[model samples]
Target: MFATKYRVAGITALAIAASVSLAGCTINMPGSTSDSNGMMDGGMMGNNQNSSGFSGSDIMFAQMMIPHHQQAVDMSTLAETHTTNPELLALAKQIKDAQAPEIEQMTGWINNANASMDMGHDMGMGGMLSDSDMAALAAANGPAFDKLYLEGMIGHHEGALDMAQMVIDSNNAEAKTLGENIVKSQTAEIAQMKKMLAGM
Candidate 1:
């Protein structure tokens, strides 16, 4: 009878040990670390995952900003063929380089959230060039192109600054970070563009 009791006790202990081992594995799963709120830590997911903490505003900002950034990139591309000014060309390249990656990052956020890419209707995205404006830009070359491009982009960047400010106060960490970055970089660029405009 005593032998049977010991055997039963041993089995219970082994079962508990196995259960704990499995639990440990789950807690230590790769690429997941929970904070006190049970939300995943930012470093673990790197803004790629759409955490529950994300708000509607976060998604809206990303969706709207993607197209906004795309326009800036398109405008920059026009400079390559339209302007021979070294300063203007360099600035165009800088805008393209900065905004293109941001477009991809925002796209990833939208995809992760299973959100629609479409703005669904005209949200009156600030500083977007009209089709006629783009056509005018495409047709122009030399100093005319440089002046138009700089002025158009200044307005575009200002619009982006407004949009970025909307989300800077949001609770979403990723969105807030992007917003701050936009405000900082674009603010400096705006100053530089103003100085460049003054020269011309």
Candidate 2:
């Protein structure tokens, strides 16, 4: 009886030891540390503040600006073949060069979000040109085309200003910087356009 009791106690001890060893090995398994660290990093990035500390407003700004910039690019393309003014041609090229990359940057911003929703339609106050207005611009040529382009772009830039102001107070650094750029650069362009129109 004594021998049997000792044998049973030994078996129980071995079982407990085996469980402890397994637990320790599980935690120290190859790649476990790296996997945990990776998960933590991903979690941090998924937060409202990404690597650049972007906010919901920033994402929305990017998404909305994409289509807006596209329209501007399209308008500029129209001017390329329609206008003979050297200044207008230069401005059209400038608009295309500046806005095309911006669309790509904004796209990347939206894609970084885990499940970003479409916020482009929620706030449509930006002075988007009407279909008739676009049609008018398309149908115009020479001095007429130049006038329509200037007027349409002025209104379009004004809409962008409104949108930029809406997000000027955003906590996201990139968004704030982009907003400031829009305000300053577009403001200057608006002034330039006004002067050109006056001259015409």
Candidate 3:
């Protein structure tokens, strides 16, 4: 009878140990409820291939940049009607072409991650034109418009470069790649715009 009692006790101990191990594993699992909720609270998602590798900063980078890029695209569109300068027109088109695709890509990343598109605040994004500034740009024409466009875009590109630097060292591969591209392309465009401004 004592032997049988000891055997039953051994079995009970083993069952308790197994339960404890499973509880620990569940807590650490990638898609665990607690862990996932925490990530989501920080503007990140969990369990999906696209979101699994993203950090909070990666998600924030994508979220904030989408609107910033959209504003650039809008500014470029304004150039079509406001400027007849061939160089200004061409540069405007280049900015639109480059940034429009990037906006779409960043949107896709946010959607895939199940993050909100809205950043819920201005984020103090540098170089964004105020309503009055945009109104002035829209009202100008010819050489006046060209001057404003070059100056505005140079500052805008510089702002983007600053934002990109935040994500350049991201652990997420996609975010890092995009950040590097922004730095490279915008740096070149900034130099080009400065030269155009000087010539004008």
Tens digits of per-residue lDDT, candidate 3, 1-200, equal 11111112222332332233222211122343444334322233322233246654555666667887988899899999988888888888998999999998887766665556765554525566778777888999999888877788787776677677556877777888999999999999989988998898
> All models: lDDT?
0.69, 0.64, 0.66
Q: What is the Å distance of residue 174 in model 2 from its true position?
A: 1.6
Tens-digit lDDT track of model 1 for 18-50: 233222211122365778744444322222334
Worst 10 residues of 2 by lDDT: 1-10
Q: Which candidate is the best by lDDT?
A: 1
Clashes of each: 0, 0, 0
Candidate 2, residues 123-198, lDDT tens digits: the string is 4335567677778889999999998888888777776776675357767666777789888988998898889989
Give the TM-score (vs. native) of candidate 2: 0.71
TM-score for each prediction? 0.73, 0.71, 0.76
Candidate 1 Cα outliers beyond 4 Å, as residue runs: 1-53
Native RMSD of candidate 2 (Å) = 23.6
Model 2 error, position 39 (Å): 21
